[model samples]
Every structure is written in C-alpha cells, then in structure tokens.
Target: MSKKSFTLSKIATLCAVALSTSAFAEQAKDKDIERVSVYGQHHKNYITEQADSASKLGITIKETPQSISVVSRALMDDFSLDDINAVLESTPGVTVEQIETDRTYFKARGFDITNFQVDGLGIPQDGGDVHGTLDTSIYDRIEIVRGANGIMTGAGTPAATVNMVLKKPTYTTQASASASVGSWNKNRLEVDVSGALTDNHAMRAVVTKQRSDSYLDRYATDLTLGYIAYEGQLTDSTKVSVNYIRQSKDADSPLWGALPLFYDDGTATDFDVSTSTAADWSYWNNDNEHIFVELEQSLGTSWFIRARYAHMTNEQDSELFYVYGTPSAETGLGLTGYASEYDYKDQQNLYDLYATGDFSLFGQTHNLVFGVSSADMNYQDSSLYDYTTGNGFPAMPPLEDFEGNAPIPTLEDAYNGSKVEADQKSAYASARFKITEPLAILAGGRYTEWDSEGLSYGNSKVNSSEEFIPYIGAVYDFAENYTVYASYTETFAPQSEQDQTGMALDPITGESKELGIKAQLLDGQLFATFAIFDALQDGIALPDTALSTPDNTVYYAAEGINSDGYELELSGRLTDDLSASFSYSHVDIEAGDDANEGKLVRDYTPEDQVKVALNYQVPVIEGLSFGANYRWQAKTSRVQSNGTIPTVTTQGAYGLLDLVATYQVTERISATFNVNNVTDEKYLHSLYWAQGYYGAPRHYAFSINWQL
Candidate 1:
C-alpha cells in the first residue's frame, strides 16, 4: 500500500550474508553435533543440518544437487500454521488452487504435485486432492525436493516430493498448551505432551480443537484432531514404534462452487467480498484416520535394517447447491438450480523395507542402500445423487429476490456403484561412491510393476510391468563451503484408462537435467541454492473415443510436454538474532506438438513469483520477536465462453503482506499476535469456467501458550 514499505538501508534490512561464519565454525570445533536423522531433529529458526529425502541418505543441504526447502517447527508455531495448505502457501514455487471451499489442488513448475510422503514412506494420495485437508499438528517439519525423485517414488512426476516428518517421543519430559482467538469468532485450543514411560520406553500425545465462522455469512466450520505415538527399545539392538492420528470436520452452508462471475445478460456480477453463494442447508463433512509402525535393528558392525508400514483411511459426505444457467437482465427472474449429494470412502496401505551400511570399495569407503516397497489403494463403493426436479420440482428457483433458504430435498439412489483399486510393487537400490576427497558420484534405479482395475459405471483394467526408472548425479567441491553438481533422473506414469478396444496405453515417461550451485554459509546456519532445470515429458495421454473398448474408455496418449525453469532460494538463520527465508522463480512451458507448441502448458500458472519471510529478535528485549511476510505473483486469467453461460475475465497482478509480533510474558508464558493481509488488497484468489473466488481481506489473531 505504500512505497516506503519496500525501501530499506543496506545494513538494517539486508541479510548480513557477508557476516563471518567464524563463530559457528568455532562452536563446531568444540562440540560434536548428532547426525540428522529422519527420526528426530529439532531447531527453531535454523535450516536442516542433514536430510535424507534428497538422496535417501543423510547428507547436508549443500551435498544434494536439487532445490529443497524445509519448514521447521519453530516457524510453524510462530505463524500458527495448522494445516498442509497453509504450509504450501509459504513454500516458494508452490501454488494452491481452490476449486471450491471443500476441494483444493496443488501445483508446481507447470505440473500437478502428485507425490506426498510422511516420514520417508510413500503413501498414495487420494485423487483430485482429497488429502488437501490433512492436519499438520503432528508433524515436526516438512521437506520439499523440487525435482524428479525416481529413487524414492516408484511412479509419478518430477514436479516435487513433499515429506512430513513426525515428531517422535523424547526421553526427557515436555509438555505445552495454547489457546487462541481470531477474527470471525474463531477459537482454538491445543495441547501436546511427551516424555519417558520407562528406562527404554517413551510416549507422546497431542489433541486440538478449533471452531470458526468465515467472513461470509452463514459459513462456519468445526474440527477436532488427536494423535498418539509410542516407542520402545526391545533389546540392545532392536527398537520399535507405533503412531496414530485422527481428524474430524463438520461445516455449515459451504458452497459447492465459487460465485458466478457474470449474470445472464453478459454483464459482470458485482458482489461484495462478504457475499455468500451457499444455501442454508448445504454442508460438507470429512473424517480421516492414520496408523503407522516402524521397526529397526542393528547388525553387528556397519549395517542396519529398518521396516515401516502405514494405513490411512479417509471418508467424506456432502450436500451442495449452486445456481447455474442464464438469468434475466431486468429482474433477474430466470435461473436454474444445481444440487448434488455424495458419499465416498478411500483407503491406502504402504510398506517399505530398507538397509543402509558402508562397504569397502577400491580402498575407499562407499555407501549403499537396498530396499523394496509396495502400495495398495482402494476406493470403496460410493453413492451419489443428482436431484433436479423431483420432490422439489421448480428446483430451478428464480434469482430475483433470492432467499438463502432452499429446501433440503431427499436424494434418490442414483449411485452408479463406483469403485477402484490400484496396486504397485518395486525393488530399488542406490549407492554413493567416493571418487576422491572432493568429488563423489551417485547412481540408482528401480523396477516397478503396477496394476489398476476397477468398476466405474462399468468394468475397466490396466497393468504395467518392468517400468525401470533411473537416477544419476555427481557433486564436486572445488572450493570450501561451495559445491557444484549436476543430476539426471527419469520417471514413468502408467495410464489407468483403457482404449476403445479394451487395451491399455503405454505409460507416460519423463526426464530431467538439472545443474546447480549449492552453498552452506555462516557455518551451515544458512542454506542457499541457485539452479536451472529442463524437463521433457513424452506420451502425454489424450482420449480417443473412436477406438472405444467394450468398457467405453476414450484413453489415448499425446505427444510431449516440456517446461524449463530457474529457481533461487535462501533459508535459515542469517544471524543469531535474525532468521529469514526468501525465494524467486521464473519459468516457461509449452507442449511438444506444433498445434500447441508456443502456448503455456497450464493457463493460470504465473510466469514470475516471489516469496519472502523474516523473523527478527530484539537484542535488547529477551524472548521478544517480530516478523513480516510478503508474496507477489504476476497477472493470470481464464477464458470461458458458452451459449448458456458466456463470460470473460482476467485477474491483474497482486501482492500481500502479513506481520507477527510475539512477547514472552514470563518464563513459561508467551503470546503471539498476527495480522494477515495487512494491506487489505482486493484480488482474485482463483478463477475457473463460469465462476471465480475472491481472496480474504485483512484478518487478525492472538494466541497465548503455556508450557511446563
């Protein structure tokens, strides 16, 4: 809102990148830091010292060749990030799209982000972004790798892999609780406790409840979440752990779609930001449950083995309403009503077994990993109904003098008996070889077998065998604290639908080449990466109805898809009193075919995007902190025209600013105050055919925490 906000003198605002790393190096000289394990590592405002998602082995940020971002627990607590969607919004180069209030999609680098993992185990996410509502209270941190990950993910794209690291039980006793109040009558209460149960046993538990009314009239939500984890050492070399989580949500008067952008008369509909497009009877409900277990054992000398398994279940039910078709220009008399009901259930099982150790090769120590993994997903029978003119004929209500009251009609058994099941199994291996003191090479591959068979209106089946994916990379450190690396990886995506003749199409294939420079400055307190990537995907699937099979599938493969992009990012504690994260990304994408060559791959993806966040602690006042966040994206639009509901719209460039202030009232008591959308700028959050969503206006929240 003001130019002065962006103005800054060289010393006060700029990150002191030139400041000495000598202090951190000095501290390292006197202490031995534990290796970063996926199990347990904690830091408030610091970057991850070591991570495994990049190469499936513990390595520092600079050792890996790709772009990665980590959002730590301290950052989440400072900003009150309670869900996965909030985490994604803060991560650079990632975008969240809301199809409606209940469904969301995540996008990155011109592709849909389809791979999600928790604690290094890969689980199948429900199609169409059903997992977007996952709660993040049980996680210690989130890791994002911005490139192809054929070594870990048996199938899927190279867009990115998001890993959620759960907080494990600690040997020392710890506990905390918080109460929060925010704009729109939102209230939240949360508690977490963890400690030792016995000499070699530990337990942890967490519970949270939140209720809130939205900015729109008659829209409100209620949620309850719970988690428990137990870990124990059975013997000198054996350990085991188990964890569980559950979430339940209920909402009132949630809209099935965004507000209409144009009236029937080819004129834009002017609605206030607080306008409601929902009926009083519309509702959405979701329930989720997850169970996970792990076992680890040490074999005599230099080898260890581990096994992990997880089961997840998600259930949803909804009754939604929307107004469709054209309306009268004079009195807004003509309009049609669209309403639907659905009951859906989804379940998944994931298992992985792996071993890590060192072996002598050519008079040098080398690392190797061998593992097998499998995943199965089942979508149980679903029920659905479309009620248009029965028991509520004239369901097509007039829009003029509209009343929010719409009769909740009974739904018929129009359920098509929907069902789907998919299975995948793979064996993978990788090794890191030390060529010399300053250079190392990495190589790996996986062979996968997958099958998908289901009944969707009719029976359908597809299967693939011997899908081989490969990964290769090399890193060379020519100078201290800096490393240059290059990597190449490939992925395969099996096509699910069959052709008209009941034959499955070939699996889509993708490859990526990336070169980057990574550096850990300020004695590893800072992680920075500058990288450029080129991705090419062939066999893009396009439907062919002419060859319809007995099951009536119009599935066919397209030619190619290509995207090239560059990313620059910095994350970690810049200094003892200052911590910040900043990122910038730019890209261009197009299809391989001449017909669609020059156009962007995805219409709404921004050509330029930037995200910056800073946290500053006052040197004079202990336990007091101040933070600010800013986000910007270039203009984007959607084009739509239909004889029934014709319209055209565009959203211009927009920026947002949010601020936070925290004060430690006492040794055990602290409070945080946040003001989001500080500028109160009006902008479009998302746009789709026939409808569009408006971004939230300024909002504020206050939270106080107590611990013992």
Candidate 2:
C-alpha cells in the first residue's frame, strides 16, 4: 500500500474495532476473564514493580518474555542522574559511548538502538548524535525494553527501545525546588510546580539550568531546560493534555574528537584525565523545542482510545576544532588542527492513534489493540565551512602546553544542502489470548511503508513498502509469583549503506528470540529476571570476494550476522532498609557469514559487563541514607582499516565505583552528596575512528532538595 493508504488503513481498522465493540456493547455481558491495566500509576520508590514498555498489554515484569528495565524518578534522584547518559549508566544491559562531547552512541546486544518513544508515542529521534539531550527532571520514568520491539514500533532494530514517560500535571498541588554545587565550579538549580488550575483543569511546569566547568581543560557547559504541561478533563471519561519543552545547551570549547592515540615516534601516547583536545575558540550550541498533545476517551469501563500528535524542531550551530596527531616527547611537532563551522536544523511531525479493549470468546477473556503511527521529518537549509583550501594554522603544536587562543577565522559557505524529506508510516495490531488460567499467548504484527529523498548531494536510492513485521510470545505462570516465558520478534530497517561497487544495498532485517524466567521474591518486593537471547541481522550487503577489485568496486550479496547474549538482573527493595538495582550482560557477536573475507569481530562492543548499585536507608537514623554503584566491563577491541593505517587496539578491562549519601534536614528539605568514579580509575569511555576517549576522573557534587 502507499504511505497514505497504509496509515489510513490502520486508522480505519482501529475505528472499525471501536464501532464493532460499541455495537455489541448491549449484547455482551461483562465476563472479565483477564483484568489488566494499560498504563498504571507508579509508586514513590527507586524501583517500579511493574511496567508496560515490553508489552502494550501492561503485563507484569514476571509475565513479559523480555529483558526490560525501568528507571524511576526516585531512582534517578537517589543516584543524582540529571541527564540521560547518567541514567543509562545506572540501567542494566546498556552501554553508552561518547564520540565527542555532544555526539554520543548507545548500544545494546551488539546493535544500535534506533527506536525511541514518549508515552508510547514514537518520537522521531532520526539519530542520537547527542545522547544526553533529554533532561531527567522532566520525566516520570524511563522504560528500556531490550531486543526487538517491532510489535509496537516499526522500522527499527533488535537492539532495544527507550520509552520516556513525561511527567503529568497532578490534580493535587505540589511544588519542589533544588540547588546543587559540585567540583569544577559546577552549579545547578531546578524548580517544579504543579497543581490544579480549576476543578477540571491542571497544569505543571519545570525549569532547570546547569552551568559547570569540566574536568577537561578549556571545556565548560551551560544548559537550560524547560517543560510545561496542561491537562483538562472534558468529560467524566474524556481527557486532553498538552505539553511543550525547550532545551538549550551550549558547550564552550567542546572536544570535537578525542586525544591523539599515537605519538610522532609511532608509539601510543597516554595523557592525564584533565587533557583536552578542544580549542578556546570552539563551541557547540543546540536548541530544541517540542510540543505534544494527546486525547483520550474511554470506550467503556474495559476499553480506551488514545490519539497523540507531536511537533519537534532542533537547531544546532557549532564551530569546532579537531586536534589530532601525537606530539613527540622530544620535538612536540606532530599535532595538527582541523576547524569547521556548520549550521543544521531538523523538524519532525509525529502522529499516532490507537484503541485497546477487552473481549470474551469461549468463556475466556482476551484483549486486542490496534494502532496507526506515522512520522515525517524535514531537514531545512544547512551550511558547512570549507576546509580543503588551507589549514593556515600550525600543523605541529605543543600538546602539553597547548593553549588555543588563536583568532577565529571567517567561514565561507560551502554547498548548501538540499532539503531532505523522510517519512515512515505503519499500521499495527496485537492481541492477547488466554488459553488457560495460567497460560497466555501474545501475537502482533506491523505493516510499514518508508520513503526518503533529496538528501545532501544525494537522492533516495532505496525504500520499502508493505513490509510486515511479526511478534509472538508465550507466558505461563507455573506457580505463584513465578513465571516462565519466551518470545520472538522481527524488524525491518532501510539502510543507506552502499556496497563496494557504490550501489545502494537492500534493507536490513533483524529477528530476535528470547527465553527467560522471572521471579518475585520477598513478598513481591524483589523482582528478578534471567534471560537468554539470540538475534540475527540479515539482508546486509557484503562484498563478493570472487569479483573483488582493488579500486573498491565489487559485487555485493545479502549476508547475515548473529549475536547471542545472557542477561540477569535484580531490582527493587531488598529489605525495608535496603534497595538495589543490578544486572550482568554478556554478548557474543559473529559476522561475515562465511562470505567474502571471512568472519571476524563485527563490533567494538564489550562481551562482558556487570553493573550493581545499592541504596540503604539507615534504620538506626531517621533520615540518613547511603548507596554505591559499581560497573565492570571486559576489554573492548576493534580492528583498524586496511591500507596505509592497518592496526589493532584492544583496550584493557576496567571497573568504576561511585558513592552517594543523603541526609534529611527537615520534613521538606534534604541534602545529598554524590561522588562519581570514587576510585578514580581511568578507563576508555569510547572510540571514534581509531581515536580514544577517556573516562572522567574522580568528581563530587552536593545538592539540596526542598518540597512544599
């Protein structure tokens, strides 16, 4: 079907379901065989006992056959996680890598996470070039579902999906404020006020700002974030809500790349954690604005329909300097500089409509959900400065005492990029069938159409239409508080990847299978999940070795890669005085599929990783609490390119420790202290094009929270 027809079909189908239900409302009696909640309220704690990210059916953690993690606001506050990156570090089975100070990458199960949602509405996050752009203060919780999410989100990977649930306006009056100070002259302030504006209307707004000097020399940051929301109850069973967000971030003298890996003598150079590759004249600034609106109507007591739409715009401008090449210990003559100034803007429109309700067949109760979603993204005019003309700057500079106060050069407009338009539309349906009191089966599918064209100096060469992805799962509660389940899901993603012959390759498809056991212990306070999964990425273009040419023009054929892993996690309150969130992840990925140059390591992802955190409320004291977090990862290895720069780098394994303490000063006031990298262990944070980015050294921050 065409893109428009695809979306229209979804809406038509969902509306049909609603109409049929309404028609049969009088004839059918309420025989509730299964009672489930779609989106339930969360309690105040560092852990969420249940979530619905993995399954739209609102299945409990013990019932969903997947690896899912929920980062609650209380957990974020306990860990002082002000940003996405910090919260991700505390989450299980996830890894974050920094390409620069702004652009970042997140990986799970040896694949990239290309799917993101807010309140179940797919957000068009095109790419996560900047990872920590989202503010945690504006969110109620973050849901991370590992493996494929094709059942709910279309055109993605089997890696994972991140769903950020925004904070809503409370009908009750609430207000809070916080102030913080930390090392490197870092300071932050935040204010949040929410209450009922009228009997049927409520409003909430959040304002937060942070300014800090970095551990790296010449690097500083100023960030401001704001969110405002209003909700109105039109009728007893109808509600409408709207929210807007504005985020502005400015990083002064941010690092475009990382420290040089090699010295003039061809030996690797190691620098202190305070080392910086940013020039004093470099800065990266970004502004993001988004508006979201949602409408909900209750079809009946057992069913509901929700419609949502969002518009987002992002603007970024940067004058960055990349300092590369290792300096010689004897001459310090190998450092080089590359400068660039660019402006880019992106805007997207997102829409989704869905309905969910319960039905009865053969004396058993079941649930059905149908939805339609579409996202259209447009790239406005963009410009980049030309650099091939000349450097005109020192190719070799002192690395140790490099203080870049050089005059900023005027920028010349290069090629003005063409307006790029991309869109994805999909229709999806899912159902849960209860075969027995303790056994249930879940199935879903999505049909999607994708299109893209008019890119910078390039046009759309590959697209897809009428592609259907399938999802299936089975859950059985063999005993009380224990469940065993398995699931299989698939996704399709169109790629711009070209073969060696410069021909655009076909799209990549991912299929994942998972089997797990979940347990609820300590009277439902402790939740633990153990899962084993294997995922395959197929339809990837691989070079044909038989017809290979040295000029890089070779025929290509489809190939497949396999990745399997094990995940074990435990979350929730261990005891009244103690709580913990921890997990261990291990993945084995293999590529090549016996084609071309043979199978080798496909990614730089670590094969083994473990994360543990504990929060203890002092039983002896009224308002004293302490916690610590630790993370360990195996070595990360990547193969260098062939030709003039063939080499290999295998970073050693490392572990990090963090500590936190909080004291209650009054009924509404509290103090907190957080120390990151408590052991001061230096490790590799990320790698980009053979460059190494080091982790930060020891740092401490103190803050105060007041609520009224």
Candidate 3:
C-alpha cells in the first residue's frame, strides 16, 4: 500500500480506539483485575526505584530486561552538573562529541543517539547536531535506556534513549538562590522558586533563571526557564493535569565550526585551549515553549485510561563565523574564513492515549499496556554566507593574528534553504505474563506509518512508508538478589542525506540483541549490572570523500556495519554516608557483509572507557562533604589525507579528574568549591570531523547558596 493509504488507515484505527474507550471502560466493570498505581519515587536518591523509559510500563529498573542508567538529582548536585553536556560526559558508555563551541553530538554503542524524550513522551531530534545549549536546571533526573528502544520510539537508530524527567511542583513552598565565580572571569547567578498557589495545593509552579559567562574568549550565556502545572481531583475517580514550560537562551561569540587540525605540511597544528574561531559579532539565540495536558479516568476498580496532548515549538537564530583550510606551519598563510547567517524554526504537536491494568489469565496475574500516538512536525530554514577569494573572509585577519575582531558579514543573499513537513503515527501494545513464580516474559510490537514531504538542498527527502517492529524480552530470577535477562528489538532511521546524484539515501535498518545480569548488593542499597550487546545495521551514511557536490556537500553511504560491546556498571550508596557510581565500557565496530568487511568503523570514538564518581560525608566534620569524578578513555585517532598523503592525528590515552567540596555554613546556607581538569591536560575536543578544536584547560568554580 502507498504511504498515504497506510497513514489514512492508521488514523482510522486510532480514531476507533479513541471512540471505544467508554465502551471498554464499561466492559472493564465486569472484569476481575487488580488495580495498580503507575507512580515512581518522590524523593531524591543515588539510584532510581522505578523507571519507565524502557517499556513505559512503570517497572523497576532491576526487573526490566535491559541495561538502565540514571543520573540522579543528588549526583547532579554533588558534581554541580548544570548543563546537559556535562551530565552526559559522566554517564556510562556514552560519548559527548563537542565538535564546536556551540554544537555537539551524543553517541552510545558506536551509534548516534537521535531519540530523546521528556517524561515518557517522545521528541525526535532535529538532526545529528545539537545546536545551542540544553540546561539541566529544570530536570529532576535523567534516565538512559541502552540499546534499541523501538518499543517506545518507533523509528530511530539502535543507540540509547535519553529521557529527561521534569521537576514537578511541590506541595510546600521552597526557594533557593546561588552565586558562583569561576576561572577566566566567569561568573554566574541562579534562582529557583517553587510552591503551591492554592489553599488545596492543587495549582503549583516552578521558576528558574540563570546567567553565566564562559572560559572561552568573548563567550557568554543567559537563560530563563519557567514551569507551571495544575493537578486536581475533577471527580472522585478522575484526575487531570495541565502543564506549561518555557525556556530561552541567548549566547554570544559561539563558533559555528571548528579550526583546522593539520598544516599544509601534513603535520598537526597546535592551539591554546582558549583559541577560538568566533567573530566578535557572532551570536546564537534559541527559544523553546511547551504545553502538555493529561486526563486519567479510573475504570471499575482495576483499569485506568490516560490521554495526553502536547504542543511544542523551537526557534533558532544565529550569525556564525567559520575558519577552514590548513595553515602553513612556517608562514601561517593558507587559512581562510567564512561567515554565515542561519534562521530556523519548527513546531510539533503530539497526541497519545493508553490504558494499563492487571488481569488474571491462565490462573496467573499478568500486566498489560497498549497505546497509540501521533506526531506531526513542520520546519523551515534559510542560510546565507560570505567568503573571500585571494585572502581570508572579507574582514578576517591572518591566521596567526586572529582575535575575533572581524566585521559582521552582510547576509542579504540566500545561498541555501529548506522547508519540510513530517508525520508519524504508531500503535503499540506490550504485556508481561507470569510463566512461573520466578520467571516472566514480555512481548510486544509497534506498527508505524511514517511520511515526509520536503525538499532539502533542492532534493526530496525519502523515508519508509510503513514498518512493524517487534520486541521481546525475558527475565529469570535465579536468586533473591540476582536476575538474568535478555532482550531483542529492531529500529529504522530515515535519511535526509544525499548521494552523489543528490538523491536521498535509503533508510537504515538495524536490530539489537542484549543479554545481561543484574544484582542488588549491600542490602539492596547498591545496584550492579553487566551486559553484552550486538547490533547490525545496513545503509549507514558515511562521508564519501571520493565525491562532492557543487554546493560543497559531501556524499555518503555505507552498506553494512556491525558493533559488539560489553558494559559493567555499579551505582548507589556504598554506605549510609557514602554514595558512588562506577562504569567500564568496551566496544568494537566494523564493516559487515560487504566488500569492506572486517574494516574498522567509527574509530573516532574510543573503544574503551571508564568513569567513576564518589561522594562522602566527612566523618570528622559535621557539615563538610567531599566528592570526585574521574573519566578515562583509550587513544583515539582520525586519518585525513593531505593531497593523497594520509596524515593521522592521534590523541593519546588520557584521564581527567574533578574534585568538589561542600560545607554547610548554617541551617539554610551552604558553600561549594569545584576544581575540574585538575592536571590541566591538553587534548582535542572531538574528532567527529576532519577539523578539530582544543578542550578546556583547568577550571575552578565557587558558589554560595541559601535555601528556605
């Protein structure tokens, strides 16, 4: 069937389900089932008690047949992790590729993570690059589910899924404020206020604001965030919640692209950590707004139905400067520059409905959940550029003398542009059945109708018409504290990238298999897991260096790729006053089932990585605590050819250490000091592209906070 036909049919099905909810509720009155509350813990801890990101069924992380990781509020506070990039860097088996000052990419298991969510609602990423900043001030915790999550996200890569859980309003009033001073003239101030607005505590709100400067030359950031929610009992058996979120970012002197890593002599170039390619006039601004509504009604005494709606919009505007071309080691004369203007905006509307309950089947109690969701998005972008011929960009000085003083380029001419519309509709159902007292099985599948009508770089985008992805998993409790499990799932990703002929590449398809064991130790205060995963994908897009288009866009397509890896993680309170987290990850990626079989792939990502975090309350001091975070990675290298002569830039194995100390000055006041990159190690920020930039040097931050 055609994509339009399938979409129409799916819409009809969803409509039928929506209309039949009343009838189903009536029928549920006669059924004998157990009532279950799908709620998680309310307090902060080093480990999460329950998470639904992997299944949306509200199950314990230990019982779920997948590898799960959590960055808890306590951990974030201990490390002073106020940004998404910093949070991901401390996550296990995850890589943060900061290719430029303003753009970043996240990867897990050697694949880019394109799927993300707020709470349990999916929000597809705009592209591989993350533009602007993602602050963590509004989030309560972050849940990461490793491997394919096709059951929750219908279409995406086999990488992990990141779910940011928002901070809910409190029934009681709470307020906090902090001021920070850091290295390189960096200073920041933040304020958070949350409380109930009504006598019954039905209406609540949370508001936060932050402003900060950066370590890089001419860089600064400002942020404002707000959230309001209303939750009240409409009737004895029904409830409703309405929420709104707003966030904005204004940044100055953010680089659009990275600096050249090599010289014309096939040798690596050296630059200070403070070096930047940003022009004094460059700036990036972003805004995001969201509104969500949910209604839940109880059916009889056991079943409950939920319906949700969300609308979100994001906007970005920027004027950026990029420096390219390898300079001469002797004369520093080969470098050139370009200035560009970008304006883009997108909006999405999503709807979801589901029901959950426990029913008796085959003389045993079982859990069932089913849902339908629809998402629609529309977006458009425009780009303009300015460059020079015999010299650097119009106002750019020589490479050696560059200091971000160039004049802003005129952006009157439209060089490239795109407008696109995308829609996805999915129906999914999953159930957990008790085969025995110690064994349970999960089975489910999702049917998706995906459609895209758009033009990018003057070429039509292509996507799959329809797909049905299956999911299955099993868990067996061999002991009171240990359980072994396995899971299998598949995923599909549509490609917007073009081939040599400017035609969109075929969609990528992949499947993942994972086997793991989970254990609870130290009287269940600590959680440990070990897992092995294997995944294979076809039609992955790789840069085709042998070909290029008139627009300077590189073509790409790799037939087959395979990845296998193992990870071990342990997290929680080692003692009453000591909390810690540790992880070790190793993965190998290679070409598969093609002429390039056995060739290594994604060498830019390290094959081995280790991370450790610890926080300890001082036994001798009444109000003092100490914490540390350390990360180490194996050597990573990338090969770039300088006119047929291959040159390799290698960042040797390295480790970074960060220390934190916090002291409670009074009942309502505290002070914190943080030191990062204690050894001041110098290294490349990332090798995702041929060009690269330097990472930050040693930095320190001190903050004073007061709470009520």
lDDT of candidate 2? Answer: 0.77
Record all residue pairs in model 1 with backbone atoms less than 3 Å apart, i.e. clashing: 500-547, 500-548, 500-549, 540-558
- The alpha-carbon deviation from the true structure for residue 442 of candidate 3, after best TM-score superposition, in angstroms, is 0.9
On residues 339-446, what C-alpha lDDT tens digit does candidate 2 reach at each position? 777678888899888777667777667767787788888776555554545642447466667776644655574655557788887778888888999898999898
Best-fitting candidate, scored by lDDT: 3
What does candidate 1 score on TM? 0.89
lDDT of 1 by residue, 427-544 (tens): 6788778799889888888777777777765646555545889889888998887889999999787776666556777887889888999876777667678889988777765656
- Residue 637 in model 2: shift from native, Å? 1.9
- TM-score, ranked from best to worst: 2, 3, 1
Candidate 2 segments exceeding 4 Å error: 1-14, 17-44, 123-128, 264-266, 325-330, 381-383, 386-394, 416-418, 457-462, 497-503, 541-558, 593-603, 641-646
Task: Summarize candidate 3's per-residue lDDT along 185-237 as a digit string, tens digits.
Answer: 66666666767666444655555566666666777787887777777667877
Ranking by lDDT: 3, 2, 1
Which of the two candidates, 1 or 2, achieves a greater lDDT against the reference? 2
**Residue ranges of candidate 1 with Cα displaced over 4 Å:** 1-34, 37-46, 126-128, 263-270, 326-335, 386-403, 458-461, 545-553, 594-601, 643-648, 688-690
Looking at model 3, residue 590 earns an lDDT score of 78
Against the hidden true structure, what lDDT does model 3 obtain?
Answer: 0.79
- Write down the TM-score of every candidate: 0.89, 0.92, 0.92
Model 1, residue 21: displacement in angstroms?
44
